[model samples]
Target chain A: MSAVAYYLESAGIATTGISLVRENTKALRPPRFLWVTFPLGRPLGLPGDAAFQRRVVLAALALLDAPSGPVLEDYPEDVPDLPGDDVFACPVRFPPRASGRGRWGSALLEEIALLRPWYALSRERRGRTTVGVAGTLVETLAERLGALLDAPERLPGTLAELTELKRTLADLRAFHEEAVTAQPGDPPWREVRRLLWRESVLGDAMLTLRDRFDASGDPRLRAFTRVLVPRGALED
Target chain B: MVRLSDLPDYEREHLLDKNLGPLGPPAWVPPGTPLRERRVALVTTAGLHRRSDSAFDLTDASYRVLPGDLGAADLVMSHSSVNFDRSGFAEDVNLVFPIDRFRELAEDDVIGGLASNHFSFMGAGLLPEAYEASARDLARILHRDGVDTAFLTPV
Candidate 1:
């Protein structure tokens, strides 16, 4: 990222950047860098947290004017673990009765099946979701995902397939999130993340698949899937 | 939140230890220039692209050119880091990519004006050579856009 910043500076496009990973920014020593102690994947702050996010942006941009040899300013604000006030929950009740052969796999399939109803409910209530931004119909995409889950042995070989898989995983979480946050009395982001990645069928399925990939002796699949697997799912 | 300095030695080792070799002496162009009078643009490694555009390739270091007029609803993060939850990003993209804030700044004349197009690149797992090439390419485009100042955000 400092390379990019330095390139921008060399181009005479004065640059300043916000960094979630302070070490990387510090080592690169860009013309201007703001080290936000915010968690990875969220350099600005949290979702729906416009004011804080705006403040972070303003702070980072403020560095552009500082007399700089190489600047990595420390942002003073704290980013909460769960930054939003609105809560989320499993819209549907328990007793997911997916009829698959495997235990956790069947439960995960059940959760996947549950997504459509929850997604539609949220769409009806809020008139939108963060999922379809991928521009594919969620229902059809779900159908396509079945094959991938069934054959976790063969991971995506090309960048396109890998990207599709990543977006699909993001879509899955987004659909679940839109569904959960649709109702106002649910849990915060961390709790919801815990629910999905620590306690739910989806997390179990991912861990199971991660182990399978690791055992498959497919180094690329193992390494990449290791990265994509949710943190809580892996940790706990 | 844990201040990086307080993390366990093993846990913080990767964060504190580094040997990024020095480069050519940095050429600093002093800024006597007032920000409000310059043409400004946004550049982010936030993996942001238009709803209609193809997402960034996590492995490849290529980037997308998005129109500056895009709003919160029309942007999405195709970034592949699972370290951060997308829920916040899913709810409001400003958490990772704050183009909306840039618009507000332009309107208030805190900065000059937004360039006609903005830029985004996925910042993970890219080869160093590829990343440098794309960054240089983006620099050329920024120059063509008449952008004098860039507000960059990294996710």
Candidate 2:
């Protein structure tokens, strides 16, 4: 972000940015930035709160008025946790993974089938979705992912293959999260993430896939698989 | 939150260890227009592009131009990193893009106006040098459109 700011400022366009990572921002200090303490994905803090979001915007833009060199101011507040944010009990529970090879395909298909209604309801209620990034049908994505898991030797380890895998995983995660969060209560994002990575069958399958990648003897595959599960999720 | 200390040790260490490339001397440009008179445009590193646009790849330094009039439903995130939360953006595009909020500001005269076009880039898997050419090119476009101020956001 600071780099972009630097480029623009050098081009004679005034720039101010919302810095999520203060350490990095401080390292490459731009003309001006407001270091926000919000979560990584959310630079403007809360999701639906318009007033709070405006405050953040104004604060960052306010930096433009500062007569200084690389001003790095901090936003004063954190996003308040929502009600029932700490508690997450997934509405639909899948049976444990079957103790056999090639079961992930069928198990994932069944889980998707089970969650279909909720996913549909989520789309209907929210009027939008973040599940099409992979540009694949949810069932098709499950099958492809399962196919790869069933045979690690099939991994091409090519850029296109890696791109497809990443998109597939992103879309899959979005689908499950949307489906689960749409059921009954308002589950905070943190809990939904925990539910996806720590407790779900999908999570188990991903971890298994990571292990397969590790065993594939491909350094690139191993490196890429590190991002499949977040840090601390395995520990939890 | 992104306070380094608030993050898990591994994540914090990874971010801190990232090479930010060589830092050049800071360049300070005075605000050309007052807050209520500046034509502000959004330059995001959130990997947001229109649905009809090409999705971003791991090493893509190219940027997509988002029309200021584009609706929230039409915008989609193709960021390669799964480490950050997407639910916020899913629920409200304004969380990351803030187009609606910017529009409201323009309506209320909190800011002068918004640019006709905004820019989006994929921010992972590459160094800042990769973005230099594209950033300078986009700066020309912004300058051509009379955008004196750029509001940058990250995902």
Question: Residue by residue across A1-236, what tens digits does model 1's lDDT show?
Answer: 66677777876778876877777666666788788877656677665566887788778777767876788888999865553534334566544433243344445556766666766776675544667545676555555555656665556777677667677666666777676656533236666676666555555555655676677776776776745675444332
Candidate 1's TM-score: 0.85
Model 2: CA > 4 A from native: A85-87, A98-100, A183-186, B19-22
TM-score of chain B of each: 0.84, 0.95
**Model 1, range B24-113, lDDT digits (tens) per residue?**
457355676787877777787777778788876656588888787776666766777665566656555676667777788888997788
Model 1 chain B is weakest, by summed lDDT over 10 consecutive residues, at B15-24
* Clashing residue pairs for model 1: A47-B88, A88-A186, A88-A187
Q: Is model 2 an incorrect, acceptable, medium or high docking prediction? A: medium
Top-scoring candidate (lDDT): 2
Query: In model 1, what is the error at residue B100, expressed in angstroms?
Result: 1.8
Clash pairs, candidate 2, are none
- The residue-by-residue lDDT of candidate 2 on B48-143, one tens digit each, is 988778789866889999998897767888887767888778777888998888999999999999999999998987887778889999999999
User: lDDT tens string, model 2, A1-236?
Assistant: 78888988998999997989888888887788888888878888887789999999999888888877779998898877667754666668865763246677788888888888988998888788877777879899999888877664677569789888888887888889888877544357777777777777788888887777888888888878765776656544
Instruction: Give the C-alpha lDDT of model 1.
Output: 0.67
**What's the true lDDT of residue A30 in model 1?**
73
